[model samples]
Target: MTKRTNYSKEFKEYVTKLVVLDGRRIVDISEELDIPYDTLQKWVASYKTKQKEAEDNRQNALLSASEYKDLYEDERRRKLELEEEVAILKKAMHIFTLEKN
Candidate 1:
């Protein structure tokens, strides 16, 4: 009976990074790391998936921030218009009162 090997997270992550980020070829990585080719390939694939997800999250955050800025500008303009209208109404009321007296 063969015992199963227990690998640590740091070791796996290091192996995956060597293959994916370091631009080392899979065949070379497998040979150098003494890991199976298919296993290394799977790790590289998962690493790519994680990188893509992170990029998508960053893009979404930038878009949301831009949208919030646009909405804030619109609200500011609306507030300024309302303030001007109120000032006009107050002036009209003052003039009306003086004319009546």
Candidate 2:
């Protein structure tokens, strides 16, 4: 009997991304990753299905135009604030990582 192998969630996600986002052939990825062809195909299908379902739900749950505009404005403001915070953190990290002469 062959031993069953288990993959981590991050590995599975990376595999799915390679096939779904990178538009790579399942056969090629399967051979390169040393994973079973059918297993990789099923993982890609599941990822695509989830993406489609999320898109469908998002389209179905649309709000009024004005509501969307208001929500968009609020989200845009929050995004800008987060980006500023991230820039500050990156600068702080750069300072911390610098070598002292």
Candidate 3:
């Protein structure tokens, strides 16, 4: 029966950061740290998953912001068009009232 060695959370995170942030080789780190290569590899893979999810969330928020901006601009243009139409109608009413006087 083999007993498992427990690694601290901070140690695992630091090891993962070496790969995610420093772009260091996992095998080299594993050998240097005297940890099994598979363990280091799994830690880095987990960090990559979280990184990907964060990137995806940022992308989705950016897309929604752009869509909102486009919708606002469309509404602004429509409002301006309606204002001009109303001004024309008011001026025509004034002209007719003058002719009747």
Candidate 4:
């Protein structure tokens, strides 16, 4: 009967990071760490999934922020246009009143 080896979570995470962040190959890491190739492959896949999720979340947040900024700038421009229109209307009213007097 083959003995089952239990690896710690920290150890697994460290190996996964080496593959994911350090751009090392799974086969090389597995051979270096004396772990099974399939096991290390699975760990790398899981780490990649988590990294993709984090990247997607960050992109979504940045998109939302950009959209909010665009809306704010649009509203500010509209407010300035309205203020200019109001000033023009006030000047026309003043001209008409002076003509009538």
Candidate 5:
């Protein structure tokens, strides 16, 4: 049986980034890094999956933030409208009371 070599997590992450993010070919990276082709392929796949998950989470958070902003803006507009209406009603009441005096 061949001796199993243990690679550090940092080394694995670097190799994965080279393959997935840098758009390097698996065979080329494997040969250049002196790593096995199958191992490099697996690392690339894992990195891509993690990257996709992170992007999805970021998009979801942005959507939730946008929704909250929309709700806040709507409430702000409604409050302003109500304040204007109350001002108008108060002016009308003053006019009626002045007329009654």
Candidate 6:
């Protein structure tokens, strides 16, 4: 029986990136990296899947950030409007008290 080989994380990542992102074919990458074709294909598939998941997460983060910003701006506008209303009511009360005197 032959021995099974285990690759390191950095090496596997490098192989995956070269083949999946850089458009290198599995057979070519396997020849260049001296890895098995089946293993290289598996790495490429996994890398593509992970890359898509990462992009989706980034988009979600951006959307959440924009939503928070909009909510904050709305709260600020509401506070400013309430302040103006309170000032107007105070002025009206002062004028009524003067007229009553």
Using TM-score as the measure, which candidate wins? 5
Off by over 4 Å in 2: 64-101
Better of 1 and 4 by lDDT: 4
Screening candidate 6 with a backbone cut-off below 3 angstroms (N, C-alpha, C), the clashing residue pairs are none
Q: Estimate the TM-score of every prediction.
A: 0.62, 0.61, 0.61, 0.60, 0.65, 0.65
Q: Write down the lDDT that model 2 would get.
A: 0.94
Best by lDDT: 2
Q: Write the per-residue lDDT of candidate 2 for residues 1-101, one digit (tens) a residue.
A: 96689999899999999999998999999999899999998899899999999999999898989999999999999999999999999999999999999
- What are the Cα lDDT values of the candidates? 0.86, 0.94, 0.89, 0.89, 0.88, 0.87
- Whole-model lDDT, candidate 6? 0.87
For model 1, the superposed segments whose C-alpha errors exceed 4 Å read 1-3, 64-69, 72-101
lDDT for residue 6 in candidate 3, whole number 0-100: 97
TM-score-based ranking: 5, 6, 1, 3, 2, 4
Candidate 6 local lDDT, 44-66, one digit each (tens)? 88888999999999987775777
> Candidate 5 vs candidate 6: which has greater lDDT?
5
Against the true structure, candidate 1 has what lDDT? 0.86
Candidate 1 RMSD to the correct structure:
5.4
Q: Write the per-residue lDDT of candidate 3 for residues 1-101, one digit (tens) a residue.
A: 85578999998999899888998998889889888888888888888999999999998777477788999999999999999999999999998889554
lDDT value, residue 69 of candidate 1? 94
Lowest-scoring 10 consecutive residues by lDDT in candidate 2? 1-10
Error of 3 at 69 (Å): 2.9
- Error (Å) of candidate 3 at residue 23 is 2.0
Per-residue CA lDDT of model 5 for 15-64, tens digit only, reads 89887778889899889978988988888888889889999999877757
| Tens-digit lDDT string for candidate 1 (1-101) | 84456668888889889877788899998898678788788888988899999999998777477798999999999999999999999999998889553
Model 5 bad stretches (over 4 Å): 64-69, 74-101
Q: What are the per-residue Cα lDDT tens digits for candidate 4 across 11-39?
A: 99999999888999988998998898998
Error of 2 at 44 (Å): 0.5
- Model 6 residue 67 lDDT score: 90
